[model samples]
Target: MVIPPPVRPPRITEFLKPYVLKMHFTNKYVHAQVIHSPTPTVTASVSSQEKALRSSMGITRDVAAVAKIGKILGERLLIKDIPAVTVFLKRDQKYHGKIKAVIDSMIKAGVKLL
Candidate 1:
């Protein structure tokens, strides 16, 4: 008789990429953060909901605002010695418009997309 080898749980968030970039869009604001999947800890984050950013960027739901958020997030990650990240978009989210903008800006800022 033989038994199957242990398999990793399906609920594990990160399998290939250790660092992950998560984003959320609200009625009036956009939020983003980088998390260390294993530890489930946030490494860096930025949002249009932040007081300082809200004061400067009036409209937070626009693609430009999202791009800025991605750039800032990439910079923050690099500052913390994270060189790459994998994006975790929502189910209905597609790699278009604002999503594309964020990924592009992050790549431009020197963060490799995995």
Candidate 2:
């Protein structure tokens, strides 16, 4: 009997491209990070839970808070010389509500989303 070859898992670089923009939302905070796929390293990150952000935000988790996190993340990425990224939304999160708010703020902050 002939046997089929085993399938290999796809490389993160194969689909994640050069860099990935990751976002996560919890009941109490929103977080975002820019990762370099090849090196598998986080280049920049921001969260509503950060002490400075929290002090400025008052409300830790909300669309506004998420937007602030996104804007800050985008700025950090820019500072790190990452101008573009592929957005990776965690789990079953949809492109609405806080997610949309974050993405919009990122775009406004001048980070190109692929």
Candidate 3:
């Protein structure tokens, strides 16, 4: 018999920080948000599934679509006065492919990634 390894949760510090950016990607869509930790509120959120964004791209699962969502998210964050953030990537996620595209687009949109 094989025993499954234990699962470790994300650090509490991630939720205690001032501004943290969390991203989620699935087979059909990508979503991102800037969360205010102290208040535990989402300051801004963007997803490829949004009507405006989906209508513009016509596809929600590609890397380009993820980049577009990131751009929009960054713009929204800037509008809300959040200029920089610490990224919180899930343990199963890597900083490549679609994730890289999103982060690059956010930087291009003027949001600093800490």
Provide the TM-score for each candidate, comma-separated: 0.84, 0.82, 0.83
Error of 3 at 96 (Å): 0.3
Off by over 4 Å in 1: 1-15
lDDT of 1 by residue, 28-90 (tens): 888889888888899999989888788778688999999999888889988999999989988
Stretches off by above 4 angstroms in model 3 are: 1-16
Residue 59 displacement (Å), model 1: 1.0
Query: Superposing all C-alpha atoms, what RMSD in Å does each candidate have to the true structure?
Result: 4.2, 5.3, 10.5
In terms of lDDT, model 1 sits at 0.88
Please estimate how well model 2 matches the true structure, expressed as its whole-model Cα lDDT: 0.83
Error of 3 at 68 (Å): 0.5
Model 3 lDDT vs. the true structure? 0.86
Whole-model Cα lDDT per candidate?
0.88, 0.83, 0.86
Candidate 3, residue 100: how far the Cα is off, in Å = 0.7
- Which digits, one per residue and each the tens of the lDDT, describe model 3 over residues 75-94? 89888888898889888889
lDDT of candidate 1 at residue 95, scale 0 to 100? 95
